[model samples]
Target: MAGGGGITPIESGIIEYAIFIVLLPMLAFPIILFLGHIFNGNQTWVKSA
Candidate 1:
């Protein structure tokens, strides 16, 4: 039988959490801006009239 290490799960979970935390904003900003442009009709480069 094979046994699992104790720290591996925690380490992987931490790594995943860190990635999610870091990427959430990185992904969200662009998506929010895109949606704002699409739904709110705001220009990306220019102010709206």
Candidate 2:
């Protein structure tokens, strides 16, 4: 409600949508790490000059 900018949760369903939006990144994060590990396979960081 603090950041809703006067929009009510019942009117916009912002609370539900906010949970989904927040969880999306959280869910994607694990999948991203898994995919990266599979593709990169413990690759080490490169050094720069």
Candidate 3:
């Protein structure tokens, strides 16, 4: 009975960690791209004459 209870929390933790790992890269990519552009300064802005 005690062993069964242990499985429940462990299973829950695995699911949560899997979700965090999957979501982190989705969030990280955009932030990295934005920072790269800001730091690199290669892009041009146009102004009207």
**Winning model by TM-score:** 3
Model 2 clash number:
0
Alpha-carbon TM-score of each model against the true structure? 0.49, 0.51, 0.59
Q: Write down the TM-score for model 3.
A: 0.59
Q: Is candidate 1 or 3 superior in TM-score?
A: 3
Worst-scoring 10-residue span by lDDT in model 2: 40-49
Tens digit per residue, CA lDDT, model 2, 1-49: 3574677659687666778888899999999999788767444554445
Query: What's the distance in Å from true for residue 31, model 1?
Result: 0.6
- Relative to the true structure, candidate 3 has a C-alpha RMSD (angstroms) of 6.6
Candidate 3 C-alpha lDDT tens digits along 1-49:
4455455777888887898887999999999999787867544453435
User: How big is the positional error of residue 9 in model 1, measured in Å on the Cα after superposition?
Assistant: 3.9
Candidate 2 wrongly placed segments (more than 4 Å): 1-10, 41-49
C-alpha lDDT score of every prediction, in listed order: 0.79, 0.75, 0.77
Candidates ranked, most accurate by TM-score first = 3, 2, 1
- Error (Å) of candidate 3 at residue 23 is 0.7
Clashes of 3: 0
Clashes of each: 0, 0, 0
